[model samples]
Target chain A: MKLKSTAALIGSIIGASLLAATPAHAQNVKIGLLSGITGPIAAMAPPMIAASQLAVAHVNEQGGIGKGGKLEVVVGDSACNPQNATDAATKAVNIDRAVGIVGPACSGAVLAAANSVAVPAGALLITASGTSPQITSINDKDLVFRTVPSDDYQGRALARTLKGRDITKVAVAFLNNDYGKGLAEAFKAEFESLGGTIAGYSGHEGSKASYRSDLAELAKGGADTLVIFDYGDGTGLTILRQALENNFFKTFIGADGMKSDAVIRELGADNLGTFFTSSPVGEASSSLESFNKAFTAAGQSPDAIFTTTSYDAAFLMALAIEKAGGDNAKLAESLRAVSSAPGEPIMAGEWAKAKKLIAEGKDIDYKGAAGDHEFDKNGDVPGTYAFFKVSGGTYESLGEMK
Target chain B: MELIGLANYAIFMGILIGIYALLALGLNIQWGLTGLFNAGIAGFFAVGAYASAIITSPHVAGRVGGFELPIVVGWMGAIVFAGLIAWPIGKVCLRFRSDYLAIATIGVAEIIRLVIKSEDWLTGSSRGITGIPRPFGELDYVASQLAYLGLVIAAVAVVYFLLERQLKSPWGRMMRAIRDNEAAAAAMGKQIEARRLQAFIFGAAVMGLAGALFVHFNRSITPEAIDPMIATFLIWIMLILGGSGNNRGAILGAIVIWLLWSVSEMITDRLPTDVALQAKYIRIFVVGLALQLVLRFRPEGILPEEQARQTAR
Candidate 1:
């Protein structure tokens, strides 16, 4: 009679603990998302997070991963800082037991988090927007991967695109961080290798106000062409605005930082004609055009921004998880098998279609909402860069580097 | 209670308690013994941190012999530099009331961060100073981390001993007299400015030593690594809670607060999914609430120091 009572008590305890739960979060496969929701980079990050949320909703609607399992993404705000990012990473890794991590938009935050913790613990950590060369170079771990190509490759592509143009010598301005330095060094190396001259390479802190004082120095450059390897808008946006106010330089060439609508909106179309190079996003590819229409139909805009990249990042991770049979440890191994390769068919912004291919055991390639989601051994795609020119008050692609 | 390796657990407790003990003692010298309130402990910590970082960063140009320096020299240089920075800042702001001093010191701390972030020549900016070789290169990474933690504790013991000895000396007597009544000490012709300056500088130097120790133990340092919240308020909380102006109190405060914080965090982390989201914020709230209650109930602290007590006994 005592043993019967004890068994009943144990059964009740298990039922109360598991069955009394009111939420679906317990059974869900959790993914961690860290973002700069309210920091200096929030303008670039907020929509990316929103887009990632949309992707998660869409994935869950299709019965989530592993047929019956749920998919839920937990988020942490980094405020674009190292300590804050580490704290977020720790919470996600230690507490959430996230199978994968999706963001931390800037290189500064990513640098503090990428290795040491998640990769060693068998979690797949991927970055959507951060493009510093060091992010990939500092690792031999397969768990650490990125969707965007490093600025090193982008810098090289920008130099090559300008090689046949009228520009002979170029002055460069860079933000003072890994993204800026690596890009500046690569651009200089690529340009000089092809007999081009660098008038000057100057750097400034990213989040600062007023660049006029500094821009005044670089404005009277001997080189007519100016390559800006710096973030255009932030605390430091004041600098570029001040330079434009003073009419410092006319022929402006920019890195991915300049590709944002926020930058164009700040500088205006009258300041267009000056070109900036960035990823081939929202370029109206047949595949991408269809994606934009569907994304808009689903109440999301498939724009060429961090949002699109983050969305694709989420989708790819889910696909990788499915391909690896829902094992987080094996998801990273399947990534190389799925990355964009020449001659392999590209799966662009169509996961529903890729789902069929994933089942058929075909060499499935993924083209994301951002662009062709290819990755080098270093976990970067090094894809074609679109040379955008501002014409008639909007940025239009003049050509692209493939 | 039945967890294996009781020996390892004791060692862990011993090392963490010791390292934090040094941190508290260093702050004790500044705020406890000397009456100079600095909310910028993190700045000096960062300074000593970057100094060793600048000397040792493999990515940095013109490194000493292209390798990290001997850990002893690195730690010593860091401590001395920490003190040197503090001495001047104290001289400039020490004349003001506690709140004003805090404001100025906080501003100084912000400036330290801005400089570290902008000046890539010194601190490596956003990429941060990485690949800092371990103190004992022969040990593996985890072992090295734990071993370095042990070294910091041992270092704190030496500091604690010296501090205990100094507290019994004439210098310490003068410090207390000034702390009790600055004007009275001045009237007694105790060279008030010189005495305060000496203590401030010495305390800052010790704070810097803690910073260097932290970097080597972690094998990394970032401008953001030494946060004001941790370096500034954590010290204040520990010192106040443990009973300020007492060595034993300071050590006890560090261990107690850190233990509660870690354990509470672990518990909150394992909570059910929906509540897990709120658990972190709840944990912070609990810590804050407990501290408030402690202050209200035991304003004199759990182990209050006897005022105007005999010198050594």
Candidate 2:
């Protein structure tokens, strides 16, 4: 009797799922908005999703996809882990029939989803926040791309900028995660190649009560400048506070992850006179201004982490879909055509103009709110960056880093 | 959706169910048959995944070998290595009672996770090892998925039949005796500690094989993939809700739970955008609710274990 009821229950669930799988409006083109909606980065996902939706809104408002087809997004919760990531990607590709997928957020999720589901199914993937250097090495058949720069580029850029400022020797303390480790390795390589000395280098696990012992060891190397590659609100704050109280390092450096207001709010800008951080920045352009105005009007903070990139990834997908004429096989090529150079510039929210250009068989280049998005051979962007210092309870950009 | 698309989705689900069914079977050997409460399924799963990944993946800098061996060798290595690691853990931890054993195993799993996260030379640290080749991966999408599904079904069948045979044997009776009453089993001269250790190691090996299949199917392995919520607790839920003591129940649990997990999103996607985004969290809640309802109403699970009756010969 129990087995019979259980069978009936399973049968109902399958039946309901089949009913749910029926196709929606035929004139709507679907794209997958895969994000870490429920896991480690849950706090950041809502704004990012809002930003992507904002892009879809711009597309539909401006004129939608080709031949009056409405651009629709199917959101999937990747949960910031590979198991859910792959499952979400599979459903997005096979069930929703999304021609392109915009994200899985975290680096590991991106790798798993792209390799297992998107790449195999010939769906184009553009991650907004997956920054690990390993992504550049995926055998993705040119179908995988990211709006955000890899940690490698930022690390190397920071190293070069620091050398330009005449700081040759530094002690590095990085959090032991993919983000911190990738940046540290890249920074170390670039700094050493430029004849700079890494007086001390160490990776520490996060959330420890005190890092004084680790600070003491790093101070023994005699480098006055301490470079941290971790989140400002987390271990990086603890490390900085300990180093300041102990007088372990005279000057400090941080990467993009460290450019947080939490550092200023916690450590106080008065004591951080010698602290500086390198962060990615959209080049001073009308593209960023337009996105900011539109996103703020949508009631979301334009400065939210990855919001711009998230917006850009979705907008680029829309353009690619338009260019590809809904053909899955040509999405990769269409993405490159719409986002790269040798075409008329299409700023964010100019979907109508871009759609007309594509329809007219004219080339178009997407100047994204995050960056120009002129993808290299590996579908990676050599991101623009700027060095910043804390001032008046906020970050003040010094100037662009070459 | 087109029939081909539905077929592809079903194939993908089947592959995942097969992998998870193996995990449930492994848990059954330890917790069901041997009456050991092992909460560190993620540790053994990670061990198998990384071992197979390091063995089969091509060589990369700053990490252990991509010996580039045959895929089968990698799968075998995963099983052997997972069992080997389980041996030491079971020896030290099996002495603890059920609850204590659970605590100890969770700690062990956390330790294993940290080691994998920190050890760059062996496991590539947090960036993880990629480029592990998938069998039949070169074929077109549908063909590749179909082939992999076939492979997974074969693996589950072999493991299922072997476990069934083992369950009906004298060893199975001894295990049941020890589980029901250790003192009584010992009075009958059963080796409780050694047999428990054997069960623990055997279960871990099966878990390792599942991990290998998972890593190969994904063509990559990352620390994120071994998250306790998905890799460990989810499998536990499947086993408990399916029927811990019944092998067929374990497979059914995998099928039902995974389908609910994957299908719930499709249903929710039909909602308005804001509601749909919020509705995603409901799927997680639904999973927990199903477990709660099952535990409340059907304590022995959907298919209760069959009693072995003594009849006239």
Give the Å shift of residue A173 in candidate 1. Answer: 3.3
Query: Who wins the lDDT comparison?
Result: 2
Compared with the true structure, what per-residue lDDT tens digits does model 2 show for residues A1-402?
A: 999999999788777776776544446888999999998778779989999999999999999987778998999999989888999998888888888899989999999999989998999999999999999999999999999999999999999999999999999999887888999999999999999999999999878999999999999999999999988867899999999999999999998778877799898999999999988887637888999999999998776778889999999999998898867689999999999888999998999999999999999999999999989999999899999998888888999997
Native contacts present in each candidate (fraction): 0.14, 0.76
Candidate 1, residues B1-313, lDDT tens digits: the string is 1111233333444554565667778878878888778788778878887776556656546223244567777777788778888877888877776889889989888888778776656676656676665576345424543565568677887888899898878888789999889999999999888888888788878878777766664455655465576567777778778877788788888888766644564576466644654454554466577679779998655566655344435
Clashing pairs in 2: none
CAPRI tier for the interface of model 2: acceptable
Measured with C-alpha atoms, the lDDT of residue A198 in candidate 1 is 89
Q: Against the true structure, whose DockQ is highest? A: 2
Expressed between 0 and 1, the share of native interface contacts present in candidate 2 is 0.76
What digit string (tens of lDDT, one per residue) describes model 1 on residues A154-267? 888888878867577888888766677778878899999989988877887665556766677776667766677766556334655665567676677777776656666776
Off by over 4 Å in 1: A1-27, A192-197, A206-209, A222-225, A271-287, A290-305, A340-349, B1-25, B54-65, B69-77, B84-111, B118-121, B134-173, B187-191, B213-218, B226-313
